[model samples]
Target chain A: MIRHPHLRLGALLLTACLLTSAAPLAAHAVGGSDAAFVAATRGPAPGPFLYLGAKHMVTGLDHLLFLLGVIFFLWRARDILIYVTLFSLGHSLTLLLGVGLGIGLNSWLVDAAIGLSVVYKAFDNLSGFPALGLPRPDPKLAVLGFGLVHGAGLATRIIDLGLNPDGMIANLLAFNVGVELGQATALALVLGPLLLWRRHPSFLRFAGAANFAMMTAGFVLIGQNLAGYWLTTGAG
Target chain B: MTEAIQPMSARRMAWLLGGATALAALITLGAVLPAEFNRDPLGIGKATGIAALWAPDEVRIDPAAGQQPAASAQGGPIRTLEIAIPLGPGGDPAGKDQLEYKVRLPRGGAMLYSWQAEGAKVADDFYAEFHGHTLAEHGKMTVAEYRKVSETANSGALTAPFAGIHGWYFLNTSERPVTVHLKVTGFFDPVAPGAPGNEAGLTARVGSF
Candidate 1:
């Protein structure tokens, strides 16, 4: 649909830029001063926890990529809201439950699964499953499932931070609220460019390339996490 | 809008998926594995000098090769040590009564120690300095003082900030002779007995190193 060479090049460049920007934020694991702060914090410190939660969501490129894939083809506002609310519900449930229940899984494995979610979403965007004769599950259910996995990953990181038990529920609720706010902010920013791009004739053509890039990033994430598991745990 | 889009051919889809997979493999094997984990599956990381990105050879002075800072938490068995340091002769100068004792500890290693000086007329008569230091280049050392007090008794714990020697220095300024009693228990390796600065012949007991 994009007949002009310059416009096609511009679209390609935009995708490339998006990906490269995501490279530094490859994993959503907290670290450095933020990790120190989390570990040091005790009791109900809602304000800092809220800020940290928002920061995590904004900087989480993996979450953002999956979100991009989820909304790439969605045209109706109501449909978008429905899918997002489902995802948020799933994410929030596991985030609270996993930490509450003290469920400790291998961090690397959880991250790998999160990576798989990205791959799955990108593949779904490309319509790869039905084409391969695989019975495609409901997209809404799939998004919810992936959201659960994402929350598990978040739980793993938070647990690793060694959060004090006192007033943890209040802090967790604040963090969850912050995460939702960050998601909304990110969605607004992404949707603006996406809406403008969709109005152009080239959007459909560029969509495939974009999903392919997301898939590649997912694969890279999987490899990195698996490598981490192998190196740290001495088990494949 | 979704209804108007055409499904791509499986063959073309396969090519794209395969291409993306190959690119990911290339990046992981060539760049990320080496840069992050120092694993060079394809040897590109080694060839391109990226293996050092994870840990530069010169800076990381690990007793065991290839062991990371995270792995340093796997400390050996906990040990205990108690030693008595006798003061110098009554006519000796202020510096003559000073003595030092130290123990080796890996980064993240921890220890609890308490010391008390006997025969000291007042708290100010005894001086103690608790510190840690690592040997730097050219026979120099980098030291960090944890505490300094002119007290007859002190008790505390230390989680080592780095792999180094950590301990105390005691000085008796009183004319009366003083004998310092020290007790230490932790996951640490006591410095070799009778070594320099270990004139008190400090040795650990209660665990096999």
Candidate 2:
């Protein structure tokens, strides 16, 4: 059973892989009964929007991938807080301004950028900079920038939903708060096992493989989103 | 032990990137492309069979082709048929409960149509859809939905989107009996009640939205 640690990591990665593959079928947007709610609803619905936001974060493989990559190697609680807060701040900014001011961006393009962000995180985790003979990027600034891009991705989805401006601010704030809460819950689940796993001697041996697998998942995500872009818009 | 601090060789980095890229490409070909666009390349799609996941549902054509008018070339009296469809018990919310009365219209032909449902006993909303569709040779159907709504009465002008069967679907939402009255004037073929043993064709097909 001592060999099961690698198996556990394999399960985690396989789950991520399956989820990432399945997610591209329907991009991160509202549909089905939720779409009916969004279309039929007449006025303010902070509670439902909050719930949806949390739900989105919970199921959003792209968001979870970036989160996992961000906290992969970090051991310090202070660093985790700082980086997560920065991401939250950046994410909340565009989600507010984009949806509030009715800023519009193409959803697939933003989603493609979000996918590329995952690739970036995975590459960074692998310490690819020195190998590629390039200077490393500052992790904080990188997260903030990608976080902004990620916010635009979220904004693109909400905007595409045709969210009515009535009480839009309240609903958006609720959604952002829900996102943070969901992130915290997900972090707890991921970090506990990860912290435990990091204490093992095999952690170093397997770290490279884990990052490589993550990079593969990210690349596949990018391909899927780009394919979505082409299929839905161009090359018809 | 100190490989983490070592500057990795270009050869090793190439192997890592190449292997990951190959894996990503394989996944995209096998699952992503097929499930999304049904574009199968490696026959992995045939193995996984996710290509059919996004296939467009078809509208079935029963052998009950309605009678064709003699003066179908126009300049004839406006073809009019009135049907009083009685809503049966235990209606289908999936549109199977709707009586689909279809008329074949030539491409670009204009058809004026109207329908109303009486509900003295039932207070439910009257639901119907006006749509036109044509079937391709290999079972692929191209459908253009004109209107779908809940109203007791509706009157509209419909220009045939293509050379195809176009008509109204009257759905009974409640168990209470509702009589649907319909009138149509157009250049088209008639959709008579039943053509032989096909009793199900009497209650034509209304697609669920």
Candidate 3:
């Protein structure tokens, strides 16, 4: 019989938390702001968008946190692929459609929603839904829905900048590609240690604590968004 | 011996998880702890690698008449003004080394002016005046005179009109260092047009060293 020890699970969880949190500090040192590069490009710059997109994804904290939460419970590679695909599909559609359509929403609200998405995922990981007797929302649908909100957030930022449209479509596509690349890179880094740690006996023991920290972070993010909203609009 | 190692009991697992969680929290707290103690304003932090050279002096805008107006037409009457002199290249305070002059206006206006370093690549933009009074009370101030002189096709001198606030944005693109002087005239003397002039002159020296 395959035996899993609580101590082994704890150790695994500890390693995962350390790796995940440290990834951003590492990526930030390499790529500070891809947005600034996109802004600087005057003409049809060669693959500027792709580079910018990758940089943004790598540096974006909210996106990373959400990804971490999604993969936290999944022990199998297939499950990771399935869930991530759902998230990607959801975000990509909104990123392309929202910006392309010129649909605008208050950024603060969108950010707040993004924060809530993190909270939701963390709670779901804790199996809070079954405990509360709530119907389990399809993870795929949830990912897609949240992706739309994320896209809206990106759209709002771009619209605010009044980006010149000369090569905007191409640039945006490049940026999206960059974002995907960055995401893939992050996944690679996260998954390697994760797969190894899962083999350890302590993975399950400390999983709850990591999820709790994520939930706390989610709350902090929501408060930040709400604070931003109040500062901008003077609304509670 | 190929004896299978037994899995930890559920209680033991819980304790292990709890310990890991506590450790994680401690690590995070350690990382963030210093920031709480060393609180600083945004943009003023060291991350940007830039600092303001000269702190802006308080600006005083006085009306030509001895009496301060209740308000002006635009929105409010003009009050005190504050101007900030950002530092320039070579790590020297832009206006600190030079002989600083404080120009007093007739009504109750005051201007704080500074000079830039020689051969410094800095914005020559000077903020003339910032009104602290209410918008409705201060009457609109118009520009009286503006002129410019140039030694070569690319090099030129510019004189801006006397308005509420004026900025001189001159770029020293020349290979040789260029010395440019800016003289701003006019203060808050919101009397009738025919009334005596309450013009005040504020000058700033700028160049590259």
Candidate 4:
């Protein structure tokens, strides 16, 4: 097959981006001292909040890869809006409820589930299970469900801080808003380049390679989180 | 006319998938390898050492009024006493250390007090208070007015100006250990010679103010 040169380059760049970014995400989650430093310095300061929010979105390889898969096949602006809104709503609701109600869960477990979400999306993109003769569940519901788990994972660190109840509700809402803004910013940065690349014929040829990269990233996330679960809780 | 391009064969697709999977597995295994072999708890020895400093060899609590019978120094109404414990030595293992002074309250009277560390950043920055206890069964006082306060009076990363101030207070109920555990995590070097860090131990006693 004759490949579009631009699409091939975009695919290669995407793979490199995913692999390089995935390392730090997995490394810190598995207990790097730097992670502890970041945790300790987190406070109500607007500057720290913004920095943390941006870092969180950028470092989150699973979230970014999932967004890539979601938008890959979408040609219309409206579809992107619909899917991102559904995900945003799902995440916002759980982030508020989980922290406000003090509903704590094992962070490692939640993160592992998040890793599975990445895998699920990649498989869906590849039409893997359907090819094997299994019924595929609705993608929208799956996105929303995974979105809740992702938000819960974000809440774990805040819960560990034992934040003062004074202004906690307000602060949490602010943080959630910041998270959405950061997500929107990342989407623009990533998908703008992606949409342009899709105009090239190579997009079709290299789509599978992109999906393979996403799947690899998902597996890496799973392995890291599972290891953390074992080390911290002695659970799988 | 544009020629239609051929799709990848199923075998090629499988190879791509398999290779990606194997690569991911290897990366993950590599990530986990360091943690698996290095099983030492991150701060276990340090924490144990800190805990050990407060393990009571002996203790005494004197009443300020001197009206009541002298309670056993082992554990009683803690007004004033002498504490001998090792302080920090300059090193990398040192963190932003803190000393926690804990006082168990007597049946009716709960003690309320604060302290300042005389010569150390870790010590001078120490602060605590206790209150609110009514005697329960067995004449054992449960802490009712328990308030934990921290030093917010000073600033600067390299210097602790309030180093030699009082450290902690308590209202003793049971004759258990009125323990003070100082966890040394941070250090400061004086610009002048014969500065503190000259002594390796901290001496601070809790008393009613």
TM-score of each: 0.64, 0.66, 0.52, 0.54
- State which candidate has the highest DockQ: 2
TM-score, candidate 3, is 0.52
Model 1 misplaced stretches (Cα beyond 4 Å): A1-6, A18-26, A233-236, B1-5, B46-52, B56-209
Task: Give the Cα lDDT of each candidate.
Answer: 0.78, 0.72, 0.50, 0.54
Task: Give the chain A TM-score for each candidate.
Answer: 0.93, 0.90, 0.81, 0.85
lDDT of 2 at A158: 80
Candidate rank order under lDDT: 1, 2, 4, 3
A51 Cα displacement, candidate 3 (Å): 1.4
Interface RMSD score of candidate 3: 11.7
The Cα error of candidate 4 at residue A1, in Å, is 16
lDDT of 3 by residue, A15-57 (tens): 4654345312311211225446555666555476676666667
lDDT of 1 at A194: 87
Predicted candidate 2 versus true structure: per-residue lDDT over B132-181, tens digit per residue:
77743332566777788777788887666567778777777766667777
| Top candidate (TM-score) | 2
In candidate 4, stretches whose alpha carbon ends up further than 4 angstroms from where it belongs are: A1-7, A27-51, A232-236, B1-19, B35-209
Cα error, candidate 1, residue A37 (Å): 1.5
Docking class of 3: incorrect
DockQ for the candidates, in order: 0.19, 0.21, 0.04, 0.11
Cα lDDT for residue A54, model 1? 82
Order of candidate numbers by DockQ, starting with the best: 2, 1, 4, 3
